[model samples]
Target: MATNRLLRTAGTVLTATALLLSGCSSGDSSPGAAASGQPTNGRTGSADTMPEAATATIKPLPTAVPAALRPYYGQKLTWRECGIVGFECTTMKAPLDYAKPSTATDLKLAVSRKKATGPGSRIGSLMVNPGGPGGSAIDYLQQYAPQPDAVRARYDMVAMDPRGVARSEPVTCLSSAQMDGYTRVDQTPDSDAEVDRLTSALRDFTRGCRARTGARLGHVSTAESARDMDVLRAVLGDDKLTYVGASYGTFLGATYAGLFPSRVGRLVLDGATDPSLPARTMNRDQTAGFNTAFTAFAKDCAKQRDCPLGTGSPEEAGRRLTALFKQLDARPAPTGSDRTLTESLATSGVTAAMYDEGAWPVLREYLAKAQKGDGSGLLALSDSYYERDPDGTYANQMFANPAVNCLDLPGAFSGPDEVRAALPAFRKASPVFGESFAWAALNCAYWPVKPTGEPHRITAEGAAPILVVGTTRDPATPYPWARALASQLSSATLLTYEGDGHTAYGRGSDCIDTTINTYLLEGTPPPPDKHCT
Candidate 1:
């Protein structure tokens, strides 16, 4: 799933941590926080239009531990209480440039562990990541670890803020104040002037990141993060990494497996992403996925007494929402605070709900309020998606998200000219989100770091079985991606949850929970192509 668009689900363990949580928030009012979950969406054209992303001519990069890097692998963690009740925290270091071992640049990684409280035999540490390319794994484990009792009883739950993420030396682009205006800036510009303004804002954002953390920004690529994970794995005393990565985390996990196939142990990638898909395809599929999810929400809302977007059909609901957006575009609604609910914020708020059906009720309430000229509900939703605290502070989720995504892959669109060219296909893919998402996809084009990664298949041939889970109507991580990833990995078992929302792990599915726990604890992959309702 495109988690950088962000919030999984809150107040619900099952979907909350397993999906997108846009900009990371330290608190709950916190409903969804810092809301551009993913600047993804496109036209509803044939899949064939989504050309395969180009791969580098070079073979897959090797991640073998070099003699010079041995010090990092053998480093010891002197963990001490870092105030997360029952969890011990510490920091570890890795050379910032794995490619240049002798380079002085280095990175400090924030790591946390909740040691197993067991009656069962201990398996190794189950390293966890909540996605985002930027989602704080430490925050994820602390706030959203909904592991089975059996799994938690035996394995130490672990996570680290990948370099340039929370608690680490983050790649900062904007201050909270600057970010405040950035999130509200119109994404779907109607005039040439507006497009220039949006482009200028993005350019400023790119500059701020470079000004603040230029040296480190280029180093936080997923490959580098994967290498960093190896360092974490070694330091944690694990012979192999046993991980549960959701959404974007799947990319990181897959990268690790590709880099260190023999070191993969008990990996579960929920809401899988297809590494082979080009940025354009991923954006379009995700855009369509959100549209699909919105349709589902509309159908369910039509049965409610006060459906904000008419009760006729899902199509009508989309029409109503589109009209409301146009209305907001002309006259932003009052949010009860100084801030008004602009189209960008409102759109992001709606997408925040698309992550998990658990947020549907919240979306309905927000829409009703927005329609009533009280934009507070929608504003709160957007704030949650963006992780904008009432105190005006934001977590670094947004900053790190672009940092990693930009470095991991090339820009989705070359420039506004290209974006204009792709709009028709994007609109066909998702009339509701296409225009705005097409523009959002351009956010990476202004990045300071040139992408070092490429779209390539990962066979992880010698790795142990990898479990890939996908929900039928998951808005963020579409079902096809799970199928694609499962196929990509040499040894992978695909698990299907005939469901809605982002992920299926603990969303009250005993079958899913049991199957996953069995695999994790018993080291037995589920029978091939398992389905759970």
Candidate 2:
């Protein structure tokens, strides 16, 4: 995937959550001004900036479980064949409120596992997550989890759908028809009246979520999910949690290490996010990252024979693409079906292309068709990003995304005015991408639940060395965030991939894959500043 698209969506959606979930404290120092020459410090900052440093007191985990109260701790889990050949499916329960176990509601988590197939002893469960605060981890495991004999030999690959996510008490918001309308709502509102209309639509969207899924929405924070992960770890009989997380999953893994430091065994955090900065800074940094990715795309596109945006220069290609976006904003294209492709859909299509370079050729083809007024290709691309099925039903991402993000950090901009004020900077950072992204930041302004946590550092003071991976041109989780996170964690090792795209492992870099694999297998963390060309 192209790096720009990966980071742009992260900027847009993450910022939206930040705005909607305002008022939470961010465990970070004020960002340095451009003149300060002090890079935005997240990990290695002063005590004031590190909440983990100052708050040494651990509030006893909600409620204590005396031996009599702990029913499931050592209960033999009943597992059954779950249809797909070698896969086993099972449900695990967790308290809705950790502190009040008596008042706790049972949350059923869906889990799937493929047993180890090898000569080496099964070390433990290797849990995997595929980004979406809502993305289905089960689906990722089924479809994308590497099936190499080497990997399957020593690990029992496992995945779980977090609470309020797919297959595990999904948080339903809009129905198929309503979601269609919501997705079509003009994102780049031109006039003041249009902006008001857009905001009203956003409010309606959030209200729909509240009206439909109120009970489960508030409890889907990252902290709660991390807690759920611990329950999984205990149930799986793994002494330590071995996990591989991507995109937002990186944050999930980091949060896990923060909550249960001693339990961290082997962790691979790809496409890392700096959990130390507030949502606004993260959004800004992501916006800048997308711009960097876009520049790279433009350079490559300009040199291609089939380049639809012209071949004069990268700057010229960017201008052409920007003009196309503007044109789409003014008039959406028809998809032959009842569904029309709006500028928002068009933008999502472009953003989807940033995930992998393998998708670039596909993007070029779709852009060509889109320029000629045929939007089927672009629509398909957007559908994939939204995980929209042909039956018109949407995945839980639209629901779980807001639920998790809004709960993770405070909002970025308060209203359209704030977004407007930040527009010039966003546009300067990414001329082809600024406006739509600025508008996407508006989603959180309407979230139902207020944020519960702030941008805080996770330094399991006594934790083992954590490997933090970054792609130099990663659009979603910028390289700097990786650097900042590594610096912040007392025992973090920064592994750098001097290349493009989002996550590094399993994407073709022998250096990155081997280094991380060795760490996972041998508990040998890569040396700090380990650069892979």
Number of the top candidate by lDDT?
A: 1
Candidate 2 lDDT by residue in tens digits, 1-533: 00112222322222101111111212211112111111223222221121222322111132243453266444456688884788898888866655444425767888888889788898889998877677778877776664356777899999998888889888887888887777777767789998988888778878888898866777777767777787788888988899988777887787777767777888888878777776656665676777778778877887899988887876787788877777787878889898777787887778777666667777888899889998888888787666678899887777777666766555555678877777776677678776666677667667777655555566766677889988898776779988877776778899999987777887788898889889888899987799996
Question: What TM-score does each of the candidates earn?
Answer: 0.92, 0.88
Candidate 1 — worst ten consecutive residues by lDDT sum? 24-33
C-alpha root-mean-square deviation, candidate 1: 6.2
Candidate 2 residue 14 Cα shift, in angstroms, is 20
> C-alpha displacement of 272 in model 1, angstroms?
0.2
Best candidate per TM-score, number?
1
For 46-101, candidate 1 gives per-residue lDDT tens digits of 32256654332112345566688888998888999765798999999888776566
- Candidate 2 stretches greater than 4 Å from native: 1-69
